[model samples]
Target: MGLFIFNSSIGRKLIMSISGLALILFLLFHSIMNIFVIFSPEIYDAICKFLGANWYALIATMGLAFLFVVHIVYAFWLSLQNYIARGKERYAVKKNAPGVDWASQNMLVLGAIVLGFIALHLFNFWYKMQLQELLAKLNGEVLHVEGAALVQELFASPVYCLLYIVWLVALWFHLTHGFWSALHSLGGSNTVWLPRIKVISNIFSTVIVLLFMAIPVYYLIINLLG
Candidate 1:
């Protein structure tokens, strides 16, 4: 059974579906928490402190990392498999149908760009919050000012703010396609439901992306225009 899954295209798509759904849930929770920043940075910091370097949070982090690795690896693997199956004849197929075709064709490239930026994102935020907490616990010092201060520091730089905006743009594109496609892969795509799911997916993705993107932009604008 394991070998069958490893060798089958459908198996790869299944993996993508599961991982994509997991990521969407994570993003939704994450966006909600980030909204706390807009209201009160202290409240956001408190939430960060609660999550801290706790064992549960650590486990969740490990699980997320594993999901990300599996998703990215299979994405590339599937792309290579498809390309090999098509050979040079892939370029020969010019015109194509819409729907799943475009996203499936470019998912590998999109996944790579998203994964690359995610590493930078973790370094900027996760390393500061979690890793710093671990180090503080080991060294008998405080964990420092928390996620809010780090965010403010990063956003204080116009260059970093612009870079964050660019990264969020990539994230927007990724989520817009990924959101409902994951559901469709899980068998939600029917004649009656696919179009509706697509609309909802795009709207959800846009709202989440804008919420996240607004943080840096708000800080940047306030800093510059004040």
Candidate 2:
């Protein structure tokens, strides 16, 4: 039964839906956490320290990695399948068939952009901070990095700040479609609720992305002024 469900298209979509929802939830939590930096750097750093290199945090990070892998792999798999199924004719159909949202049609491209930026973000923050601490622990040294300092340093550069904003734009586009689509896939949407879901999705996506974007923007202003 497990193999059967995983092997089928509907089941694959179900997996995508579930994984996407899980990621959205994580993003919500992460956004709220990030918002702390704008108002209280000390509190933000404290929270970061609390989540750093501990066993529970490490386990949670691993689980988050698993969810990301599952989501990305399934997304590409489904996209390839759809492309092949649609064949060359899919491109010929230039006009959108009425109700299709722009984001719905370009989800794959947006997702790819989001994935690429995620790598950049992880390298900038995670590699320098959490992973550094983990390595130090293994080497028998205690290292505590200031997360707020890292944020300020990274956002001080105009290029990095611009790239981050671009990344957030892509993320916004991806979530605008993904939020409602995931619910639709899980049987929480219908014609009657579709409009409402889309509105909610947009609001949710915008709020989350803005909360995240605030940190970088705040630091950029601070650095420029000083």
Candidate 3:
């Protein structure tokens, strides 16, 4: 069973679907946590401090990273397989399949864009806060950076704010396609559920994206007005 799961095409898609769904849940939680920063810095900082390099937080972070890596690797592998299976005919017949939307067809490109931004996001925020906290522990020195302040500091800059907006937009496109596709991969492939899943994916992804994008736009407007 284990061997088949690792070696079979359906098994690979199943793994991707599970990992993708897990990451989407993480994103939803993260988006809500960031929203708290807009309301009360104290609350957000407390949450961040609690999560800062603690044993449980570290474990969770490691798990999240594993899911991300698995999702990406499987996605690349599956897309490559599909491309090769189609050969040159892929570009010929269904560059834009009749029912496939742009986002669906361009999912690999969207995923790449989102993956790049995820790195930038980790550097800008994670390196400053949790990584510092972890490093400080190694040196036997106390150090904690309030994540709320980090959000404000980065979003205060128009350029950074705009860059985040771009990332969020890319994320929206990625999630819209990925969410439904994940559902289908996970056994929602019946004709009855197909259209319904797409609608659910679009609505849910939009809500998540808006929640995340709101922070930067809020800060950008505040900075401009100030």
What's the CA RMSD for each of the models? 2.1, 1.5, 1.6
Model 1 Cα lDDT, one tens digit per residue, 48-157: 98888777988998999998888888877877887788776546457776545455466667677777878888899988788989788888876744788888888899
What lDDT tens digits, residue by residue, belong to model 3 across residues 1-226?
7875578987888898899999999999999998999999999999998999799999999999999999898889889888888777434443555776788888889999999999999999999988999999999988878888888888889999999999999889989999998889778778888889999999999999999999999999999999
Clashing pairs in 1: none
- lDDT score, candidate 2, position 162: 81
Q: Which ten residues in a row have the lowest lDDT in candidate 1?
A: 97-106
Q: Model 3 residue 211 lDDT?
A: 96
Tell me model 1's lDDT, rounded to 2 decimals.
0.82
Candidate 1 residues lying further than 4 Å off, grouped into runs, are 89-104, 140-144
Off by over 4 Å in 3: 88-95
lDDT of each: 0.82, 0.90, 0.90
What is the C-alpha RMSD, rounded to one decimal, of candidate 3? 1.6
Q: Compared to the true structure, candidate 1 yields what TM-score?
A: 0.90
TM-score of 2: 0.95
